[model samples]
Target chain A: MAKGRELKGRIKSVENTRKITRTMEMVAASKMKRATDRVAAARPYALALGDVLARLVRPDIAERFPLLRQPATTTRVALVLLTANRGLCGAFNTNLIREARARIAELEAKGATVELHVVGKKGIGFFKYLGRNLASERIDITDRPSAADAASLIDGLTDRFAKGDLDAVYVTYAKFKSALSTPPSTEQVVPVVPPATQGTPRDFLLSPNADVIVEALLPAYVRNMVYRALVETVAGEQSARRTAMKNATDNASDMLTLLKRTYNSARQAQITQEIAEIVGGASALQG
Target chain B: MAGALQVSVISPEQVLYEGTATSVTAPAFDGELGILPLHAPLMTLLGTGTLRVESSEGLKRFHVAGGFLQVVDDTVRVVTEEASLVG
Candidate 1:
């Protein structure tokens, strides 16, 4: 009876856990859909921007823009680390932090002073535990990153780089490849590189001329890149949470099955022992 | 068909319009820019204002803010930070 009671308690607890995980899985799935759609929505703009940038970055035009100028010496750099605000999403944050640490090490090894700008609570906590100094900490933008959020996030970094205070600017984030795969990636976002174009150059009616437009476009381009990263990171986090919750739910189901079998056998054994005791008493009384 | 340009007005969130238009006018950073069919290749920064597309179906307008406009080979591409149709 005691054994049966203990098993019952365990089964109840496991059942409760199963319910919680199942609900979390559903929530994550819905969030994943929204995040994925956001990423998809931003793609057209990114592609169009890329097309325009390819044409705008002529050699002469490229030379005039400050963003297009590569520093003579890469002495100072900034790393914008994007991670999840909350935990329970498998290795999503861990991988990003690891990637960031490695990048910092690499940059430091090359004699460049690396400034750490961390986004998300998990990254902030991890770095704090490690006693690492953070240039800035942002904890609010992980759940719903708007265009304004992206613009403000990179505004300071862009300004510093333009003023030659920071030589290079890099963003480390999890790039959403698919539902099952997201790899942490580091990209140099500043010193705007002219993406290669395939066709011959065509003359354009210069409205305020190409040089002026290029200068304005460069900042917008940086803002868009940051926005893309934020969107991708959000999508990746949702997918990771969905997968993690799904695994947890499946494991809970398996545990429930094993517990049910144990409970049934324990009850059966107790009943059989009670029957044997009753028979033994009757037989002794008759003798 | 003779005086129409392929116009695509794109925002970060979605593509507002993608079709043929007789003329397209957008708010450039410096001022307003007007485009017609066979317009030479042009690239300019956009400002916060109204974007009017003169299509055969009638006139459609959108409030656009902060982006760039590119015209290449009779195709006009308007990429903006934000865009919404004007009621």
Candidate 2:
């Protein structure tokens, strides 16, 4: 009887845990949908920006823009590492940190001085524990990132790059390929790589000139790139979290089932013992 | 549709407007520039001011800041950093 009672307690606790995991799974699923929608909504602006850039980035025209000027040699580089502030998202932060560390090592191997700018609480904590120097640490910008947020981050980086203080700027984050896949990747943000000309260039009347327009456009372009990275990283975080929560919920369900089976068997054993005791008493009384 | 130009106003967050407009007046870096149908292909830096789009329905104005305006093939695309409807 005691064993049956203990089994019932175990089952009840497992059922309570299952309820919590189920709720978490639902919450993550909803958040993932919203994040994915944000990613989709931001696509047209990026494409439009790309279209404008493609038309303006001829070799001769690009030479006039300081943002397009490649450094003579890469001496110093900045790596902006993006991770999540919260960490229930299984291996998401871990994979990103590992990838960032590898990139830093590679950059160091090439003799470039790397300035680490971390953008999440988890990344900051890990690096701090490792006693690594951080150029800047930010944990404020949450899931919903605005254009101003991107502009703020780009302002300092672009100023330094324009002033020749930094040779190159690279951003590392998880690129949202799909809901199921997010791969850690890095892209160079400075010395803007002009996309190849697609078709015949149209003769557009430049207001001031291509050079002046490009001068204004490059900064905006850099900000947009940073914004894209931030949004994609958020989407990836949600996706990772949804997957983790789903697995957790599933595990909880399995545990509950196993516990229920064990409880039933314990109850059956208790009942059998009770019946056996009653039968022995009857036989002894008859004797 | 022949007289109207297809206009898309897009920001980093959302597509504020996408439709046909008979005319568009945007704030260029220097001053306000008005674009009508069959205008030449043009590219100009945008400034912070109201972007007015007039169609058969009515005139819609958006407070736009810091981006670019591109006109090609009777299609005008205004890509701004931020755009919101003026109250």
The prediction achieving the highest lDDT against the true structure is 2
Candidate 2 residue-wise lDDT at A169: 95
For each of the candidates, the C-alpha root-mean-square deviation to the true structure, in angstroms, is: 1.7, 1.4
DockQ (0 to 1) for model 1: 0.74
Q: What is the lDDT of residue A239 in candidate 1?
A: 92
Model 1 alpha-carbon miss at residue A15, Å: 1.0
Angstrom error of the Cα, residue B52, model 1: value is 1.1
- The alpha-carbon deviation from the true structure for residue A258 of candidate 2, after best TM-score superposition, in angstroms, is 0.5
Clashes by residue pair, model 1? A204-B41
Which portions of model 2 miss their true places by more than 4 Å? none
Error of 2 at A267 (Å): 0.4
Per-residue lDDT, model 1, residue A223, is 87
Candidate 2, CAPRI quality class derived from DockQ: high
